[model samples]
Target: MKVAPAPSKAEVISLGCRLNISESEQIRALLADENNVVVINSCAVTSEAVRQTRQAIRRARRNRPDARLIVTGCAADIEREQLSAMQEVDGLIANTQKLDSRAWNVPASSRPVLAQHTRAFVTVQNGCDHACTFCIIPKGRGSSRSLTISEVLSDVEHHLSQGAAEVVLTGVDVTSWGHDLPGQPSLGQLVHAILERFPELSRLRMSSLDGVEIDTDLFDLFAGEERVMPHLHLSLQSGDDLILKRMKRRHSRKDAVDLVRRLRKYRPDLAIGADIIAGFPTETEDMHAQNKSIITELGIVHGHIFPYSPRPDTPAARMPQVDRAIIKQRAAELRAETQKCRDRWLINLIGTEQQVLAEKDGTGYAPSFARIQLPEGTPAGRILNVKPKKLEKGLLK
Candidate 1:
């Protein structure tokens, strides 16, 4: 006799970076067969992020009244008691526990459904070793840990076999991968291994990487590798040296500039992106000017501009704070500058051939990570080579 398939029983609402999104997939796999479970994979990068998380929790509770709402991620880990007190949150899982089979109460499984995603994000590393004075993530994510090279290759192979055209290596601090493992293999070695093992893998990408920790091998890969995507989003918190020092960031303004210049020398078309915080404590006008100037100087085509919002217990929170109004204004100005850079890049791409990974509804992303509107009815997950004839509504046509 034939049997009916099981119904959908779980849902995950991810509210953070690519790393969180990648982990949410694992959480979804763990709860795939369970009933009435809703997981809130939260973010706590800033106080605003924590507030948004709370809002998400309330919304999730309203929508899924019958489901058991589980909260997990940086916010949940750091603010356990506070989140636990929320009536909507039924359980709390730490960032470390999210990957543990025991936490899910299920047999260890590798069968993850990519579900509506053409690209698969394989988390090879987690947590951070360095403590940036402005960051609370290390507290939530714990010390650096890495999956062995073989384990990472296995996951990559699994995703490739499941028809993933692109595989992105994601983590809390991806560049710190392999430090906790045998021989302390570098991230570049891991990338080399993945490429060597799976020659047919279409595209390989990395999430945000710290500029200071990038190694020689990784630099060579960026210079010459065609398979590794040309878009790099850097974890550059500030472009001012004084701000960098205050934030306890390893890379200085000169370091960031030199890195970008070197990469662009090899791959001129490389799309550079960075996370810059505006109005950090004690930031003078001259410092803010330097921050604004770096975008143009480095040709940053993509930017994640964040208004400085202090988190409780972080060292920066105790520093003399910037006025809220000035912070917002500086953030706005930085965003405008970023937009100009992006528009300039987009203008340059006009009439150039773009390798677009078609996502949903005739929309996709180009190699430079720019949005492209493909011919209507173009199916998702198909990589198409087409010349972008013009720009339409901020998207390449």
Candidate 2:
């Protein structure tokens, strides 16, 4: 008996970060030619990712009324019950294994799957053991688990065969990767393994990392390898020790500072960035000032600030809530302080050489934590050596 072919499709999409974007690209490539099947990759990190996801879905539904929709990713993972109940979505996938079109509840089309972009995200690990008070990822994703080395290597080989320009290793706790392996594989070992097995991989980027994961041996790997990008994103929620304790963060202010110092020592040209929560519950004015001062003293290249949003089922949520007025005020102040530091950094870069990966839309270069806006007609999606000619306040030069 001959099997019949599936129909064609369109897709809606959203991405959380570099890693999310990478994985989502792969998902879209798989669903690209379903003729009438559509996929919408959703994100729910900040308020912005959610807004973007909704907007993308709305546009997809409007443009292709007959297309079957598959919504998946962090946003959907956290709210699976809610997402599955949505009238628009025919299917949803969390931080799960790559499911075929058969499970998608949509008939498969005979159209060929394609490569989405120049780079791809190969997630070797998919869960988190750490439970930061403010985070809800563990709720969405289960306990720490890793994909077999063979599984990951197979994906890497396939990526190289498909001509991937780069691969970003992604996970909730990428540093804790290989912990569940038989020999308890370390991050350095996995990195070395990938490099040795796939010499064609030009560049490999790490997703977000934590201070607890920093070690001298890992830095040796970075120092020994040029394929690793000279960039790092460390999660540092607060600079005040008391606030950190309250937030139940495993790392202290000193730990974060030391991590930055060590990374920069190894790679002088490294662009360092941090995440911050401006107003945790019961955080006082002095504590906020301490947090601001620490960031300024560390000389981080930039900061991504978030006003404290209490999530349900977290210890921090039950703590005495600070007045909304106070939270808002502190958030604004932290933002302003961080803005000054960022602007000063940009100002100094007016005459420096940088490797910039520009976008195809001829938009601008998102160099680490900052965005560099050039003349609109400039070429997109090319890594070019750029010299900052001038500075326009805090954003770009």
Candidate 3:
């Protein structure tokens, strides 16, 4: 793997989301020639995220007192007034404009340098059109939009040229890509196009997808495509039917189960990951139980359990709220269940060979996104097949 020379002048502190990390790298390139500038690509997915953004702003200001500091990303747009009012914040760029070269008042670098990252993330879509009651992303991101297939191919080509062994298609609503385009191509078509165009590209992965929107074409690729990874992270917020309805989610509990079941038939080793909210408004004990049970039912080894936090102006915020203590307890229980499932799954993989992509962190990831401990001398960005004889500290080695 060829790593780009580190930038000397500009520094970026990416706060959240893989999309922000991808965008921050582009920002880094745009500012590569500039002097004494720092950018904070912030997130406002939760109140906690927004608070972290503020903390980052102050810390960046202290570290670079003479340098110009700029804030951009979802938090900067959604919490514009409050964040801009901070004395430490020099300026705020609109989230939508953050990617444009003009936003930084600089010509786009002739060659955008990818920061020290092993897997290149290529954002195919941005924004969300869905009105999930618990989400404030659409307000921050505006409308659902997609890059044209040609544009996507170009992005993939650039990453490949940068020596990216794996390319991940990422976005706010990745599965919603191409809906606003001319022919309304499905997400599967985008993946097919990339694989067809770049045969040398070994690994092609996708970010979280809306389970209900996994079209037949995408399902087929997941089931049989050798280059496409056998891992799927669904944007499933709850397991109880009522909570899903209240959240304005498109899929029912059964929809998610059936989708996973069908995909696993062709690829029995497929890994399941999900975003499960523990305590939504109006959630009862039974509702939380359903949420806990679904983890084992779906065999969700990589679970992201978010304790429901009310965001300003969201519908869920206005509804009857769950007690914070109970929410915390529920979140803990959900996490424990996920760990049990993961521990068992890892145990089952003992002595099984996995093709792992090494990262700079002295770790690697399998096609199913399972973490593997690499030998001490392994170089970054090399793909190797290794058999794990033990599981230690939640990593297969």
Candidate 4:
């Protein structure tokens, strides 16, 4: 019997969602070694996701031809056949189990996340059970599951020791968290545990949630836990009740409207964001206007506007498809409205102090939860006390 030391040269690539990024880290650990190696986390939510995944694969082949190419994530699940056909990939880990985190937290300079980025991601939950008509996540990522409260606390402690100043708790369906567990612990409780255990962390953030996720328990008391990021990414698939029913989404328009009202009522300065899908099948022009008006009324700080992409296996794929022209037209209109809302929020924050994690110097300033910029000399890594005094029209100036 021979004891193999394991492959020293390997890389892992992921495509789509923060959970995928977290999983790719796990894949790295699965193939890690005490030798020269490179690992790349990939994303494929949009064109950006595909580009990054391809770039990562290409970079590895160019730089480390000897390294084994391992591929995984939602993109792999969605396009497994296509990725499988790629000669570049040496091994494939499709929509399998979650990737462990020990793999890819390495530092370019022996420091995780390097000098500029202050916050690192910690996914407390994985998978989604929702059947939103347009989404294929449940097919790719499987069922709703979560790490225990003790497990999450331990990860935070490890990050704090590794010099992370902030942690963003992420998952596919974060609001659906804890339902799988026996006691059904709430996300708020997890937040409390993290803050209680490690007060050294400067900030904490949650991933997007549907309107059904927020209860009075969270919107009311979350502010008291000052470390929690005062931001929420709520989904408003459509503002029309008919579309809501047609799409089989969980809540009505009023539910989403009231959810924002609660967040604002609880924390007046809270930065609220939203995701609006335009041009689903059977979407009328009037229904589109209803969404635009609802968005205007909600006053969302930022909006991730997307036109419907009919995935192969989703229910919506069987329905009559909206013309690409109509979808594009509506998406352009929604995108303009989204930017207006974002601009208003940025301008409103012109002088308010906010905590920002500096991510490298780019066009002008540091970008954070808010599309805010601190002055030129503002340091990148540490949590900075920033009062955004000016808004550069396009990128943060």
lDDT of each: 0.89, 0.71, 0.92, 0.69
The TM-scores, one per candidate, come to 0.96, 0.83, 0.96, 0.84
The model with the greatest lDDT is 3
The positional error of residue 244 in candidate 4, measured at the CA in angstroms, is 1.8
Tens digits of lDDT, candidate 1, 1-397: 8897555489999998999998888888877778778999999998888999999999999998988899999988888889999998999988778877788777877565656478899999888999788899999988999999999999898888777888999998998998998889999999999999999987898889998798899989988899999988899988899999999898889998999889989999899999999999999999999999999998888899999998889999999999999999999999999989999899899899889999977788887888888998888889999888888778888
For candidate 1, report its TM-score.
0.96
Query: What C-alpha RMSD separates each model from the true structure?
Result: 2.6, 4.7, 3.7, 5.5
Write down the worst ten-residue block by lDDT for model 2.
361-370
Clashing pairs in 3: none
Per-residue lDDT of 228-329 in model 2, one digit per residue for the tens?
A: 776676778889999998877888888887776776786766666678887788888899898889778777666778778776577788888888788788
RMSD (Cα, Å) of model 1 = 2.6
Angstrom error at residue 307, model 4: 1.5
Where model 2 places Cα greater than 4 Å from the true spot, the runs are: 1-8, 45-65, 84-102, 105-116, 363-382, 393-397
Q: Candidate 3 lDDT, tens digit per residue, 7-110?
A: 44988999988898888888888887897888999999988899999999999988889878999999998899999899998899999998788988998666
109-148 per-residue lDDT for model 4 (tens digits): 2322322135667888877887877777676678998989
Candidate 2 TM-score versus the reference: 0.83
Which runs in model 1 stand beyond 4 Å of their true positions? 1-8, 110-116
In terms of lDDT, the poorest run of 10 residues in model 3 is 108-117
